[model samples]
Target chain A: MSKQEQLQQLLGELKAALPELKEIIVASSDGLPVAQLGESEIATRLAAMAATAHGLGKRIATTTHLGNLVEIVIRGDQAYFIAYAIGDKGILGLTTPAGSNLGLVRLEAQEYARKLAGIL
Target chain B: MEPLKIVITGPVGAGKSTLIRTLSETEVVDTDAIATEAIGKPTTTVALDHGTLRLDGHLLHLFGTPGQERFDFMWEILAEGALGILLMVRADRPETLPVARNILDFIKSRAPVPYVVGVTHLDQPKVWQPEEVALFLGTPLEHTQGLDPRRPEEAVRPLVRLLELIGTNA
Candidate 1:
């Protein structure tokens, strides 16, 4: 299968595992949404937010003398957004309801990210 | 008591927050929290995140800087009072070396603090060896170690050694 098809299959697998997951987006490291699952509106907003967050992460790394931007988790009243970098140019983002098992979500997302990185 | 300020910085997905969370279990204050408060918003830690831990009666203040370069102003403030820096590099992508160098230059220009590089994501085969990375970055061989930023034990030793090195230098 083509890499894009493989990534789509993986996303399908993830969605199947966690039906509560509202959206899964493959975004550029800069936060532009490359591929998304779910409503267009939600994907658009998340893409922008992810890009902004990624940009902010890079700025922080440079100033603080740390190293790199890894992942970011933001908790909201109704939902939560977690963005994880896939290599340098891609991010794996998941939007789930509040109180979701973040540990599980992170693990799944990370696994998918690894697979996506291989294809991307 | 004075806090031993330490700053954690790295590129996107390099595991800075995970590193800070692990370090918080050690004896240091969370500087990233302080930076968050300073920004007055949940996502606006434009400068730093603060945490603290008490180790051997010493209160270590930990500062986590934002990973983006545009928010550079915060680095100056966070770098103040820092005894040393723990530079976290992603082993998966050596391209981050330039970003690491940029941060190192900023820190060197602002302070004479000793630094130790922690190479994260060693579990991934794409990551480079610590020795090769050290040579690539021109950092001393003794100052770099392979680490898993997700695990506290793996992340903290290099930082502790950095503190010890700073103490010896002083």
Candidate 2:
């Protein structure tokens, strides 16, 4: 399968696993959208912002001697926006409804990020 | 020492980050990532590039905004309370002039600060002159000049001019 197809399939599986996820975006390290599910209109902007967050997170990690960056989570009053680094060249961003299972979401997202990294 | 905030903005590959790095006295904080598109550069700034320098005994905090439009929201954030702006445009790439103009308009609409346009890549062949760029950007010729961002002395011309426009000598 093509890389795009693989990415879509993985995103599909992730969505199925976490029905609470409002959105999923796969973006290149440079802020370009690779794949997205839900709200396609905001995908471009969200992907860019996700990459920016990932870049800033990596910098923060290095500056504070916090070892490798794992993820960046922005908890809003209504929802949660989480970004994970998929290897060095990609990022995985997800939005989940507030009150969702945070620990489970992180676990599943991290696993999907790893699979996405391999395809990227 | 008084702190003067100056914002450096331009399109991708216009040398915003390079200029800040060349002019900064302290270590620059940059958020550059590998570019997915072939924009003639390997990496692009996703967030902001921050640096500081002392100009005429005043501490200048320089913030370089990401060049892509998707990150344009940062322009207003960085331009907040900025005393002046230095907009960089690649002289060799006239096509980017419109985008540069849009960026200038967006920031000036919010901050209404003094600005100077730095026309980089003058050393390259088939490049636009500062006057032509100024005309296209609707900025005064005096506020636009060609400079090499990689060179310390040349890289600082626009900032100094911006400072002068802001009624401060650098």
Candidate 3:
């Protein structure tokens, strides 16, 4: 299948697995939206922010010798914004309700991020 | 020495990163990533570029912001605590002036700091001069000047001008 189709399918699978997610965006490492589920209006800005967060996270990790960065999580009053690096080329971001099970979400999202790395 | 924070901002491909890299005394901390859009370059600054310089015995901390509007959130974040701003624009690409003006207005509204406009790419033929860019931007001609971002001597002129402005206002 085409790369775009593959990306959509991967996002679809992730969405199905985590219905609690309020937003999902798959963006290129350069801060461009590839595929997104939920709020289309915010996908572009959020995608850029995802790349920015990933870039900063990597720098912080290297500076502190924290090993490779796994994910970046921002806790808000009503929701959680979490971004995971998909190999070297892309990132997977998810917005979840504040009270959701973050531990389980991280496990599933990290696996999906690895799969996304393979596809992209 | 207390560092004087200076912010360099403009539209895409305006040489904001290059100017900071050129003026910095130490290695620059840049967050550049691959470009997915047609921005005339393969890479773009996603977050900010940070560098330091000791100009005339005064320590200067330089921060460069991403050009794309999608990253407008960063403009304010970097502009905060900044003592001056150097807004760069490409003389070759007149189309970006509107965006440049918007950015200037946005930052000025928030930071209200002294700012100077640096018109880059004047080395190229058929490009706007500093005076024209200043006219179009509605800024004082004295507050705008042309410079080559790749050269340290030329790139530092606008920053020096900004420092002068900040000092005069203070």
Candidate 4:
């Protein structure tokens, strides 16, 4: 019934749908965690990092005339940190184990991020 | 529990970075670039600034925004889900009051969060006192304070007030 409760339910469903998702964070584009399923400390940093990352990405894109950034993906040895731009502002930070189906993960991530964006 | 997110904002040269540096035990990570255009300082924050502090077993995340209006977008982004805002302004530069007001209005527009008008430059004489600033900004005197951003004890006062507000609001 409350906004916080609804946020939790939304994130829970998304994680359930995406088994590859190790954790997910719905944060403001500026990088404040709204509702997250992960370590509290890391999630807090993830919000700030994701926001600053978005700022850098936007600056780079504008300077290079790259138009606009859609998503930013960072690949590590055993994990992936993929962030989707939810409309003009807001981001969905997804941590998935390596070797997950990239296509499906991205598609679902985008959809879920859009829904989360509306919720915010 | 997530650390209470707080945003520090004001006009150029308002001591945002210094306030965070003084308060945060961790080394503050900031994206400061050499100013292409003339401003008081050679270096200006381009992206955002971040630092962390632990109080009463709770983590607090501090995010500072670029003072220049060009980066007003960050103001909106950084203000999201914030427990409150600390609108830092210099005591000597009353001219920047308008900019501080704009930033405060912008954040208030997004979320009805509690905020304080932090008037820096307590060491400087002939500057507006916190009470005067509160009057100028149309905020209550209780919501404004004079502080030295370089002093950790003074820097943390606004945050302590914000935390109290969050507790009461919760």
Candidate 5:
């Protein structure tokens, strides 16, 4: 299968795994939306937010003498958004209901990020 | 003894750099300088801000991540081996709560570390109470406190308390 196809499949897998997720988006580190799943409008906003978050993560990496940011998760009362940097140019953004299995979500997100990194 | 690694972070213009410079007597690494040198432009730090201090014979390494959401990658790396976190917020910037929440989320995901909220610009009129700031950030009550980042002696006390909290929690 093509890389794009594989990425789509992966997104499908994530949605299936975490049915409570509100949105998932793939975005460039520059804040551009590349691909997405879930509510269209929310995905667009999330893509933008993910890009901004990724940029901030890069700054944090450079300032601390640590290497780079792998992932960042934001939790609210009813929602959770997790962004993971995939390689240098891309990020995987996931939004799930609050109180979901964070460990599982993180694990899947990391796995997909790695897989997508190989493709992108 | 080895220096304790501490990360100070918050929204833009929140006085993170000023706080570290005032509280620590040692020379700061000035990551912004490095960033400028690297990018060859007068760019703000796209990464971390660094400094060092000595207190009671122990060295404390201080790092400050950029407050903007675009440079968040630096937070993960800076967080490693961190003894504690000092979350700085400006009294005038109510928007800092979202940024603070994001930082807290990042920190909680890694390890449970002690953190103190330093409310900067408290000397300014119309400052929010520490309790109110805590509520805004969704942090536990009593975890937030007002601070004058320009005052080194005053800033160091809260920092020391943060370190103590880390020690106790760890």
Candidate 6:
């Protein structure tokens, strides 16, 4: 499959796995939007925010000798934003309702992130 | 004139963010995270900064890019359709001049827009004057000005001159 199709399929699988998955975005490490299953504008903003969150998380982890960053989660009043590191070169941004199944979301995210990272 | 987008760029500690913070009429939107390295400063800009001002009956949008090369991927993205470039350089730190020139070259090689050099930190003792900076950057003396970036009045001086230069300097 083409790279774009592969990314769309990856996001689609994640959405299918979790009925509560509100949005999913895959972006390069440099904040370029690769593929997204959300509004175009949010994808652009998500690309930058996810990259920054991943960089900050990685920096903090490396500094504190915590190994490497796996996930960075920001829980707000109404929603939860997750920035998951895709190996060392990309970020996967996901959002969901505040009380959604965090465990299942992370599980599905981890699997798809690895696959997406390899394809990227 | 319609809304004009101007790119603000320089090396680390060269006052690119400070200039925007001081001159922007609205609250500047910035994406500065903790520095991963020892750069004398605790935080560094990762994504572009956003600010706007109305000058000479025209809205001027200021976009500031990070100085670190690791974040250099943002340079082109933030520079899209920029009418002019305002290259800020720290007069106190001579080491940053080359990187400042590289940023200029990178953007100019792509857009070839008119630009003016803003030599900052002039209030500090023993710094390069505008003429010498103009000589070093290889731009004409008229296209360079020294200012204290901490002051909004002084910070906007070079940009006003840049807008004027776009009429002739480009």
Best by TM-score: 2
In model 2 chain B, the worst 10-residue window by lDDT is B161-170
The better candidate by DockQ, 2 or 3, is: 2
lDDT of 4 by residue, A1-120 (tens): 887788788888888888768778876654557779867778877765666566667666765789987888889999999988766556788899999989999888888888877776
Docking quality category of candidate 6 according to DockQ thresholds: incorrect
**Which parts of model 4 have CA positions greater than 4 angstroms off?**
A1-120
Candidate maximizing DockQ: 2
The DockQ for candidate 6, computed on C-alphas, is: 0.08
Better of 4 and 6 by TM-score: 6
Predicted chain B of candidate 2, TM-score versus the true chain B: 0.96
Q: Is 2 or 4 the stronger prediction by TM-score?
A: 2
Question: What does candidate 2's lDDT look like per residue over B71-157, in tens digits?
Answer: 887887898998899999999999999999999999999988899999999989998999999999989999998999999999888
Off by over 4 Å in 2: B168-170
- Candidate 3 DockQ category? medium
**Stretches of candidate 6 exceeding 4 Å from the true structure:** A1-120
lDDT, residue B101, candidate 1: 83
Candidate 4 residue-wise lDDT at A57: 72
User: Model 5, which residues run further than 4 Å from truth?
Assistant: A1-120, B33-43
Give candidate 3's TM-score: 0.93
Best candidate, lDDT: 2
Ranking by DockQ: 2, 3, 6, 5, 4, 1
Tens digit per residue, CA lDDT, model 3, A1-120 = 998899889888888998999899999988889889899999998998999998888877876899988889999999999999888788999999999889999999999999999988
Estimate the TM-score for candidate 2. 0.97
lDDT tens readout by residue for model 1, B1-170 = 76788888766456776777776855422223112122223332333555676665567777887665644555666787789888878888888789888987897689778998888888887768899889988989899998887677787778778878877988
lDDT of 6: 0.82
- Clashing pairs for predicted structure model 2, backbone only: none
True contacts preserved, each candidate?
A: 0.03, 0.76, 0.58, 0.08, 0.08, 0.05
Over B43-82, each residue of candidate 6 has an lDDT whose tens digit, in order, gives 7777777789888787899999888664555787877899
DockQ of each: 0.03, 0.84, 0.69, 0.06, 0.06, 0.08
